[model samples]
Target: MNIKYILLPLVACSAVALAADPPVEEYVYGMRLDIDKVVAISEPDELYAPCRVVSAQMTYEDSAGQLRTLEYLRLSSVCSDIEGSL
Candidate 1:
């Protein structure tokens, strides 16, 4: 009914929508990953870079039904092409 009351909910929703997501975790050598069901994976920016290391994010559910996210590094897909060419 009032302007203040209407604006309050809108502000709250905006805050939640604009909140920054946490950075993905970097993978370590021999680190154990417990990915249950794959939710989504963030795509690499440079898919065409040859032999270049690219960053990726994986969102998944763990064995305990907890949602988790992990970031890891991997060679670009083009690397395989180069390797195969040689």
Candidate 2:
């Protein structure tokens, strides 16, 4: 049997796999409010330059116990790049 013929299918399969999206990982995080104050978040340096804070809003609970809502600020960073040693 020729080695090239045997390897051809394996190479093709790997190529297709490589072209697919990366596997997603899910994680949860906890946060605390240290103090009530104006807040600012900085983008990680690896992200593309000129990152923008897209939107911001405030929500609150009314004295009557009514619910409130807030719009989240959207931030983008160049997360497609894998950084650091695996």
Candidate 3:
């Protein structure tokens, strides 16, 4: 008998639910290196020497307004002399 009352409540409930939902976050994978901060130089083994590297943790917001963080590695390097000795 009263469709308007039922429809109004339904619309209001939908709007509230959408507003209360948490923002979506995006998952990312990759390597980011900063060549400026080379902490040390040591050979982990005979084959590779990952130069100790340090970089600031990356922070940004995704498209859905969610806070995101990309952690940096403590040590990473492209060992050009992989065949050389320590």
Question: For all the candidates, what are their Cα RMSDs to the real structure?
Answer: 3.4, 16.8, 14.1
Q: Write the per-residue lDDT of candidate 2 for residues 1-86, one digit (tens) a residue.
A: 99999999999999988755233222224422222332333334544455454443333444554433334545544322323222
Q: In model 1, which range of ten residues has the least summed lDDT? A: 17-26
lDDT, model 1, position 54: 78
Worst 10 residues of 3 by lDDT: 34-43
lDDT of 1: 0.78
lDDT of each: 0.78, 0.45, 0.48
- What ordering of candidates by lDDT runs from best to worst? 1, 3, 2
- Clash counts per candidate, in order, are 0, 0, 0
**lDDT accuracy of residue 41 in candidate 1:** 84
Q: Residue 55 deviation, candidate 1, in Å?
A: 1.1
Error of 3 at 36 (Å): 29
lDDT of 2 at 45: 53
Taking the tens digit of each residue's C-alpha lDDT, what string does model 3 give over 3-81?
9988999999999998764443233455442233333333224334455454434455445555444444444434434
Q: Estimate the TM-score for candidate 3.
A: 0.31
TM-score of every prediction relative to native: 0.63, 0.26, 0.31
* Model 3 spans with C-alpha error above 4 angstroms: 29-86
- The candidate that wins on lDDT is 1
